[model samples]
Target: MRSLFKRCMSALACLLLALPAAAQPLPYHVDPDAREILPNLQPVPAIRFLTTADFPPFNFRDPGGELIGFNIDLARRICIEVNVACTIQAWPWDQAANALADNQGDALIAGLSMTPENGELYDFSSVYLALPGRFLTRAQAVEGFRAETLDGQKVSVRAGSAHEQFLIRYLPNIERMEFDDELEALEAVKSGSVAAFFGDAMRASFWLNDNLACCGFAGEPYFRPDLFGDGLSIAMPAGNDAVRHAIDWALVRLKQNGALDELYLRWFPVGFY
Candidate 1:
């Protein structure tokens, strides 16, 4: 019975991925969603991944002191499919890139955006996740809201983030309050101090549903990949094609077999799509 239940769930997961195809366009800046994995390549014997637990549902730990979430589960699945050993350790969020750079880890798989500049420094797999931008406001204020309606209203955005740059380019007339981080900006909205908060749709979805329920989605999710770059991909030091290809191959297998969709549904029951 348990095996049958698992099979049914897997079948439904694949259906969910296909059902949303037309309604939701793929979030990518580049054409061709995935690269073809090279044939007959050997995966490295071992891998140590560096990631952070600060982001919930994506890479945070559980109450049982177990490291679990989308990235953690996907990372383990990738290693399993490729038949390689991999370890994920929760390090300080800021240290993931450097740890991979310094060889302290083999891959960095927290929610990382893929960009050409980073491409110069690291070989990135196809995006396993793409988080679009969302606007959140008090429920009463959410109806019929548009970017133009925000003119002169206090809007909160994370300083030095893509969302902040987006407002500068598109919503220039709004009053911008730059917060040091996402929680601060969202809190401003929760307190009614700011009219709205602009942030990653995934985080905003999780936050509004779980932590701060006073706010709701203000508008459609924005998927301007030119502004946000490609979705989050795993990163390895530049020129390491073997490990890179191995992980990418695993991603392709995961998607084709529906494990990726299962993880997505598990974490994002109220997903942006």
Candidate 2:
């Protein structure tokens, strides 16, 4: 699943850093002029959103056992935009897809892969978020880091990861050190054994702020949808045009009105891009 749910660690600390405003622009954008015409104001009487409790910051349970996360808030806002009641339920990740397929839910926002295989079975909304690749370097080396000058330098990456494939394809000049996991790669950077650790930007952001004070982002986030796949999107049963149009229409408005950016900032304080 090369999605955020798979790459991200349980960094409640990153969620805690949610702030009132973001210092940078949000990653996802929608053209204000683009529009989707729905047949009626209320596309559905109510939307039953299916998600999972295991993916933190995106969808997870709060200390009070209440379902809470960026996805939860976004689903509520979507319901408001469509002028319909919203009912969200947390299901086991393995069953969420089948539940949606069986008409048990109106939408699935649990980081389902937006791949060709899934596209045949479900209709997807516009990409709401993308987990970008990034370079994490020691804090002292971040001041003037240059991707072009990384030739012959040791850069750590997780073995068999999309990020590693990206590094091999685009930046083949650098020395690659493959690790079993991102933590090992990050540790290599912290220990000065590598020039940088290349992997998911969101995870890098969390590690940078949570406890790895010795490092920081070294360059702009790398967006390679072809390699990493198109990011988080809401999925619905195939041919469900009404619901799909309603969600897409609402998403554009949310992005234009800055509501989406606000949600992004509130959830991811240390912006990955």
Candidate 3:
């Protein structure tokens, strides 16, 4: 797994400092177009971020067994913004959540998507990245493609993914062909067996980096928060509002200074937004 900051640290630093530091454009991925500043947000007294390193680009272990990834970078930066010593430890995903709950960890820094049920057990910081829905079609397809125009086209989606369920519920008019995996679905599109592949925007974009000989995104990203959950966030145990709020404050500081976008682009060079 490639560590976003480790791979692009110098480039990201240059990108952030290109302009007068005060007037840089805050990078917002899409829709809710502005980053919500948490005025009342505050940080915990100390910072110890618990995480799992299986999710690459976001969180993963390097070949040296060192913890390194976007989430790891984000966690360290947040601690620096809060002016505290920070320690990150990798645990099993389930244990990370438990560690936070048991007070063994101060925060959980995995790629956790916000959900209603999880909301009851934990509080989360504002989103750092959204896993949106996107369409993959032949590069030569018509311009100005839109959902309304997909009515008669054959689109493939993983049989039971959230994207598939979203297609069934929201864009029922389009002809959806279910496949067992996104790779197979994408292959179908490549073979001209299907007009497009509909799925997770991040995965699809990454897929295109290596296999886009015949395809590209067909439309603007679909960010149905209802279907995709609420994006990746810092999950802190419920009732730990101080820690949650503090992380939120740190996020705002990072975003305002362009550090957030730097990390974002480093990890997601082939971004949908």
- Per TM-score, the best of the predicted structures is 2
What TM-score does candidate 3 get on C-alpha atoms? 0.82
Error of 2 at 97 (Å): 0.5
Q: Comparing candidate 1 with candidate 2, which one achieves the higher TM-score?
A: 2
Instruction: Quote the positional error of residue 142 for candidate 2 in Å.
Output: 1.9
Per-model TM values vs. the true structure: 0.70, 0.91, 0.82
lDDT of 3 by residue, 22-64 (tens): 2222347433445545434334457889998676656666556
- Model 2 Cα lDDT, one tens digit per residue, 3-71: 444455344624554444448657765765686665465557888999998887788876667888889
Global lDDT of model 1? 0.74
RMSD of each: 8.5, 2.5, 5.9
Comparing 2 and 3 by TM-score, which wins?
2
State the weakest 10-residue window (summed lDDT) of model 2. Answer: 1-10
